[model samples]
Target: MVSRRQLIGAGAALVGAAAWSRTSAMGLPEAPTMDSAATQVPPVPSQGPHYNPVVTLNGWSLPFRMNNGVKEFHLVAEPVEREMGEGMTAYLWGYNGQSPGPTIECVEGDRVRIFVSNKLPEHTTVHWHGMILPCGMDGVTGLTQPPIPSGKTFVYEFDAKKSGTFMYHPHGDEMVQMAMGMMGFFVIHPKDPNFMPVDRDFVFLLSAYDIDPGTYVPRVMEMTDFNLWAINSRVFPDVAPLVVRKDDRVRIRVGNLTMTNHPIHMHGYDFEVTCTDGGWVRPEARWPEVTIDIPVGAMRAYEFDAVYEGDWALHCHKSHHTMNAMGHEIPTFIGMDKTKVAKKIRQVQPDYMPMGTKGMADMAEMSMPLPDNTIPMMTGWGQFGSLEMGGMFTVVKVREGIEKGSYEDPGEYRHPPGTVAYEWTGALPEAPSAPAGSADGSSLRPAGKSASAAQADHSGHE
Candidate 1:
């Protein structure tokens, strides 16, 4: 006795449910929009000629500006929603509001001072990631200092000690916070500066996300099956394509803060791992690696001398992390053809089959009940160790330019094709509270014994 409209609506709901299920299966949400005011923050000053100011992301600030005397520069980062399809909402932590955050350009050795203000309720801190700095300025809460509580401000002051691609992110409760999308890139130029730089330099802050809306609590990682991964906060196709000209010296700054070590593979040329967390390593440390293995809590700098130009897939070595999960939300059939629709209906719910299922084609019209036990153990093979962390990974597209081939178009080309990019989603989980025993559990000690006994038991653990 179902009316035609009711039947059609039910079908649409089914489809929507299916899509949502798939997104869930992927361990990520369908692209999110800037939902809570907790995620939003004030804007940074534009990077213009003769003037550059310190900036903040998600609440952490650092020193920014050029010392090499470069006249023109651009600093862009913003918050943006990850688009799933049309109406779906997926939010991410981004620079200028974009996932990978913004690409910051400055001369090497410049005295940089950036002021960061946190808008999110959770405590957050910004780690220079791979940049070398004094122990006090390293940004590690307790280690370097204390956590920057919510709604507070902190300033990161340091010299751009070396020239290479670097990054920034929250060091506290990194596993959770980073997985939620709080990370970005920091680029330092060489003092002399090589004008031979390519027509474009792209920075990509790679990461992963566990998007089960049911598992949104901070600190506690739901051991759910994660299937969705992204480059600059986007899956393939949805993510803007990287465009580039031939023969340009493309510099890619990649940082891996996810729990896993991303062995980033490039298509065309061999790249040099020019720098590490301690700044420029000795010549012996510099080596040519095609697929550079960037461990979690670390960064890698590489420059590719662009030779040929074509579209190539740059992604993490982990197979499962690349695609969306099998069940994010409920599946939808809004755009499917009639025949396919009939087949799907029969496959999913044959009992509801009817002679004419045409109107029920669009899955957008329906809403199905979400499933239970969807959350899975977030820890496994690639879980515990810093490098194998689930979320951090990205892509870099190296393209040909006028130097190697024909000049097609001409413009400011601020963001050249194949340029690396990312957006920050939000704060990660807070670190686990101190374990039982020690003064505040903040200090490490043996179990089952008093702090003094544990301390006396073993000094090696510390």
Candidate 2:
């Protein structure tokens, strides 16, 4: 088992390496490196994906915002634990260190330069899913260029040629890596900015996870049984709600990069399919599409005039992947039990009882009474039924006005705060005194006695 201490050390090392790579690639001063290093600092155990280091690609000198400035961003990836089966752990990739990376927003025609530093061991590259860019700048490992080796840096420079929703992810080992959670959203605004004006916009990157607990790794591309589907890197309720005000025109950029296609169904008013990967479709092409089927490696942009005021559910229509493998309570046959089963059911279903049966049962129990705890048997009715059909869905709440402490009108939508909540109370206190004797630890403390004593002495100052 990997100890918590080792995990923390690994996470710190990864962050430090990523920071160095970004600084080197973009030639930016170490100062004012988007406070993502401060705000979305990795946890001790560092659950989920390590934040893909962010690089400012504005010319040779990287541009950054000052404290609390409007043009600032904290880009990080979220690490996620995908249950391929029971007792297994496969770390999925994410932005802000999350499975679904952060949503990057900018205006069309804006000169955008993004520095991408690989943190994982494998070579990876970020393909600007739908955005049109110079052939050389397009991020295809072998097609456009070689893979960005681990610890190395690559600068993605391009002009936001067209305005619409786009996505980014590793193109190398795509099937496996993407399935494990290497995806995020990229939005570009129009230069003139006229269309169906909107109060708020959200991005959804639909994905699937096949967790096999017995192995601690996510089951990627398993042909037999497909399980666990998600929108924006989470299963239903865990997916987070998009809050909006009534009458607010909201735009949603949906991207599907999984091997399978996702027919995303949104409730309430019908949405207009304004754009596709090929760019803005003709007005004649625009149509009311309630459920849009986003094929792999494709993106769709739509605008919905929020009218109804209520909580709407969004999810995948595929039944099997919607909920954990059907809370089946069947027991596993192992060792002597396996022998007994083999003896009796040799003809019925060979090896029907495998090793992690109990764990599978446990997952079924955990996934039951899907989101809101009100709907039971996610595969049968309501949201559950939608999910079972492999329809990746999420809810849009159209309220009257902007909630308190928010910028837009009440109808303008934003994700609920609890979406990214963390339990910090149980974490090890910020390395009291820092690990003693090490150069880094000593540097963290005043140039004096041991780090421990210095920490204690400086406690009051803090």
Candidate 3:
């Protein structure tokens, strides 16, 4: 097998005038850019000490060159068109090609030099999140070093002092750059490969965007009110499934770049959080968790054995995070008949559709026409039926016979007889009713008002 450095060197032909003129002039290595949104299998080191490479969901690892006993990498900051999902494309400023730029992996104690070319409209600097290095290499644009001006290239040399989960993003014009999707994972592997070895490892970042349903660029000024919650910039249905061979020990590392926290939940098995952005946890200090809360600007890594054979759900526990392009102004219409109003609206608009009186499940599955360049607020078709999901949701498929090193989808799981949930249809029995007076609160009124007055006040408030 060819070394990743060799394969990346072949991409020198892809270097444009902006990269070639500056990088070659400075004897810098070529920066390889990715063009796809699919999850890529981790690359193997051709002649180096063995280590388990990580799978980047909807992303890839950055390739590095061995130059004079040092690892050399180049990154280009520029605008890119990213496919957030099947039919949605977002224009974002990122490194190399994709938003939440390619994962950068290195081994502990390795000396590394990274050349960064700025092709964006503004100056930017690469902050090594969670990394310990010289004060000058901290990447704070004004404090540690001057910003890398637009159309210029700068280099940062550092040594990987520790092995753990880390990240990189712009420190100059930080808010706008980050809101426009410019961040990536930086992983430092242990020098001893056998230390905490696992069969498969995966990494992704939690990000949220405020792009309108039909827009191509995000609202850089958005502080809260982010509508699209994503894992590695790709929403559900477009996010690739995590495929695992049954009984294989697996590790998943997640970092939160969003403004808020994410409680990432897994269905099949309980796992222990073995690492964080700081460093590895002591074996005696680790704890089991089914859902791990990844705080803003932090990382959490968990491990579990793939003992269950099924299609299990993995998603952010916050309900809104699993939906897409939602509107905050839509009034709840459950149990309210909007037919007469809808009829009146149809006479003038002819395309008015009433909100579902039952629930959004029925509404989301309807064939309502949506805007161009966007998908429904909540959508996905599973083998069973409508998945009714969108952002920050994906399945973890555990199966019996998957080949090692294969990340390909194994299709839907075939349930054994009597293993699937079925609807009840046999007998109807009388059920217990609500306790007396609990329905209207007549028996629990406060001294300030009578039950009738309280009811009237509640009605008025509604």
Candidate 4:
């Protein structure tokens, strides 16, 4: 965690630095800021009901100070520069120096005091989504409480009444704020330590941005055709993998903040949804699934036993969601003969070339020049070769003998002899042909076994 005062030495806002210094002197809780986007350890809960902390994928947990018996937390809502991928960055509005701000962890029935200091240019309100609280503490701007105006701080005091998956985001001018990436996961664990325990717990928020190719900001008004589908504001190859020990019971919680729905699919396991934003599903009521469709503005949590030792693919089932910038506009050119077209066009421009005639997979392998700050539509490479994937995609690496609580990537998995898929080099036998087709190009009925003839034969026997 980076302190705001430390940033001032590097020539940041001086007045804000003095203000934060005074704010600390005034007995206010510290607003811990995150400077790194890599996965960090969930801080050990100093004092609270015993519960396992969740690992925030590509994010961190906001630390709190215990004031008397209440958990006190200070959050500064301000503008931040978020790295969308390796070479792409977006200026967004978030809390404590990062978008989809730190996960707030609490126990059910705990009295929590959150101090939200508005550093944004406009007034904002922090709405606690999917949590039961006092009407006045609901964080609605006009209906419940006044907005926290720019440069002012407001406090929300409430008891976390339920334990389940929830979220927090700006309710004032939400369309603009949330579109600019103002959101975070809020998890209230069950008071009972035995309840819903898992070996490895992970949480992330699903968000989309319409950052045009080579641009730094998302189009806030654009409702659909979003090009950057992300998990925790980072796209694939950059989004860290979930490393787990073989046979560990894992629980993954996902909140959907995107405008559209996502059918999240994971290979090599059929898991059951154990909880949702509403509440925990009864064990008897749960059913098995390999793909869970998370609806807009909702959350779903699923659990599975990682018994298989391998790297499994986990991504949105929608093909385009697995691609990067401007994925929706590309036209299909499969099997088209563009040789003549390329020859004719190259006469005028000597460097002219045609692509996609064979398929879009060629795009992934091409070294074609791209605009500055733009990531390829389909990217990532695997041990085998080009992965041909992007956006909302990551791998689950399950390995044997991984130490407990270690989340580091274990590198690529080493397949056992005869366990991996290999290309076929054996000779092929005579291919079987379908029984001769009729003049209409439909296959003829099997010899002496037409449906009508069978019915007639049965009638004669009767």
Candidate 5:
């Protein structure tokens, strides 16, 4: 595979000006926003929360300062210790001390001034992944402006004109910085609560890393093979589940920064692709969907009414994305008789044990030793058995009596009797006879000569 650096260096000359015009917001539709505020100290237009804030696990929304009617937020780009899962951490570069950084929340028409202080070992620049802004504020390092040098601070002032789900990340190093987990979600809530009102709103960025076991830092140069897939810099079972009340309208805004696309699949109910980083889709333009594919550097918002009362799964459709610490070069052992060889090898080496003789599903249940501070290739245990899942996997639990805006863990769902899968407990019934023409005494052979004569003729033949 061509390295990202080589692609950037070569593609830069051919797609530079054309790429900016096509990608960096030329004819974006204006985002929709609310027009009124009802419950507040004085009913401020863009003040006080308009809707119930979505909980970002291991992250929070950036608090802004009211500086003479202009909202101000400070983003410090520095090194951070990000927890990918239980017993696993990576040394990554992030904004505001979080791998995914803090969620930047604003309203349409709000004048925002963000101060970004760079403390990294090298220069960097923040790119608004899907925002309509001035060319100078677009944050392309060489095209729009010079890179922000280390130890220096840069300020980006712009009006929050569009209301939708968006993201921010380094546009300077492009490959290295992004691969190191430097990204965050930027949400501009609609000004009109009635426009896109939902009982609950959630946001997270889909990111991937290539951090090997026993290593503290990620390999930022890796572009294709990623061992650690995460949602908001966390893997399961460390990732939190989406909890909602029955009949509640929920919005899940997902942004993808990984090298590949992710078809995010949700079970039990169909949702609508109501919005994107570009803008909100019109009601008539929206369609029901169970899975939405989010491409690299793009964001998608899925909204649906939570009607099912169970623990439904939500994960990346790519099977490999649902695993961790996988070895791409592991030899396949299918159909191989390794039992005898394994026993002989075990006599010499006590730890020798052949695996994958049947399939890899057994790895989920095997109590094998792993490196310290590392997760297994696939690890998630449930009431049934091992979940056999790892990265980019989470559950959406809807119950009957959850408090409004409360995200308390509802625990595992208890299935009703006869609903759970189990072994057969009743007496076995007799199977039916074989069909006609079958070899199980259902058909007869042609008879020509006596059996003894045919046996004697064959016995004398060579």
Candidate 6:
């Protein structure tokens, strides 16, 4: 067993190496003993046509190999370069090749043999969150089992008896490793999926990071001030949308590993909370809602029928969560007088300008310079204008005709003429005067207009 003191030292060394890896531009350090044989881990065999796997955004499904009757999987834990968006990337420790790792899918009642190879500089262990397994395979380092040291591998074999959405992450030195973005989703499909079959299934994990603008690695210690919120370790414009045909049943499974809860809202449809990490929520127990809040270290699965054909939004309801690289301490300048201050400041610095004086809506249009590898606080484009969003935001494009198993971008939606909102511009009706037998002295006038204007209009009508 590795000592706690040794683990801490090893973690510091790995973090230092990550910083070095960023400056060298050599990318992440190569995992030790990484070769063609090591990279070529056995693949998971297909479970026939009945099994429909979900497509993880900016992620992939893990493959396994069947030995005798048990399914075996090998996961390589190492440093990874995860793209947060188009321009921003982070140095993170994740399973396989990407952050949030890869989706592990299997059928209930099947025995699973998962081999985890740790290539980081620290000791780690994989804890299967919310899974029913024997005490020996629980994966609690220092308790249920020993931790896997640097460059070492460990195997966890168990029989997946329950079917539901689940998650996995490091149980040894959890705070540091998990904050470094080491996590993945484990999905056990029902033995009979046809009983609750859906045409489209999507899975993603909700995670938050505190990487300051212009920096790469996340500050593992800074838990309260997370600036970047993401789904599957990606922000908007880069996060993939869910595309489905009209009238298709869609099930979206979301697992949260962040510090705060997220109320995920979907536009244009009402969905039911069909499942949780524990198990499926019965039809009688389920309730319809437009938004569902998922607490930290929990999972929520939403199901609905895509009856509307258009581009709709899916995002966290918290206003700040939909933004990226946010500065929480910025002074609010709403209704403030900055004209005199700006003029004097411009004399000394030509580029000096006061921003957010009125509001932040206009800032989206300005092409202000940004850091070398940073994105705007809110960055997304649409036909109307800037989306003014960044994290945990994406569109659900429901089209008229889409192939059953095809996963292609449906392109921008074309709105029907009457569906879009437009300004009222036909004609205005004459203002009405007060009734003859009025108890109180009042007149019918537009809400913000003065009484004098109402009198003038009444005189004109007379």
- Clashing residue pairs in all predictions, respectively, total 104, 61, 0, 0, 5, 3
**lDDT of every predicted structure (CA atoms):** 0.50, 0.55, 0.87, 0.87, 0.78, 0.80
lDDT per residue for candidate 4 within 309-410, as digits (tens), equals 999999999988888886565787878888898999999987776888877787788777788877888889989999999999999999999999899999
lDDT of 5: 0.78
Which stretches of candidate 1 lie above 4 Å from their native place?
1-88, 93-96, 213-224, 281-289, 327-462
Candidate 2 vs candidate 4: the TM-score winner is: 4
Q: Supply the TM-score for candidate 4.
A: 0.89
RMSD of each: 22.3, 25.8, 6.6, 5.6, 12.1, 9.8
Q: Give the TM-score of candidate 3.
A: 0.89
In candidate 2, what are the lDDT values of residues 1-462, reduced to their tens digit?
222133335645323434444555555323212212111212211212212222111100122222111222333223444422222234776444345555565666666667676667678888888778899888888999888887676767777778776777877888777777877767666666465456665566676655542333567776435455656544543444566766777767677877787777777668889888777778787999787888878988788877877666655555455564233454554222455655677678664443453333333233432232122223322322233322244456677756522322233234466753467777585555655557664545656588678777778678
**lDDT by residue (tens digit), candidate 3, 1-462:** 233334446554222233344645458786777788988675575433456788999998876666666777889999999999988999999988889898988888889899999999999999999999999999998999999999999999999999999999989988999999999999999999888889989999999999887789999999889889999999998999999999999999999988999999999799999999999999999999999999999999999999999999999999999998888788888899888999999999898878768888975578788787777788888778999998999999999989999999999999999998898998988876656479655644456897788778778879
Per-residue error for 289 in candidate 4, Å, reads 0.4
| Cα deviation of 145, candidate 5, in Å | 1.7
How do the residues 265-369 of candidate 1 rate in per-residue lDDT, one tens digit apiece?
A: 776568777667567656676788778887877777676666655445466776556444334444454445567667778888875433224432222223333
Report the C-alpha displacement of residue 98, candidate 3, in angstroms.
0.7
Ranking by lDDT: 4, 3, 6, 5, 2, 1
Lowest summed lDDT over 10 consecutive residues: which window, candidate 5?
Answer: 34-43
Error of 2 at 46 (Å): 31
- For residue 92, give model 5's deviation from the true position in Å: 0.6
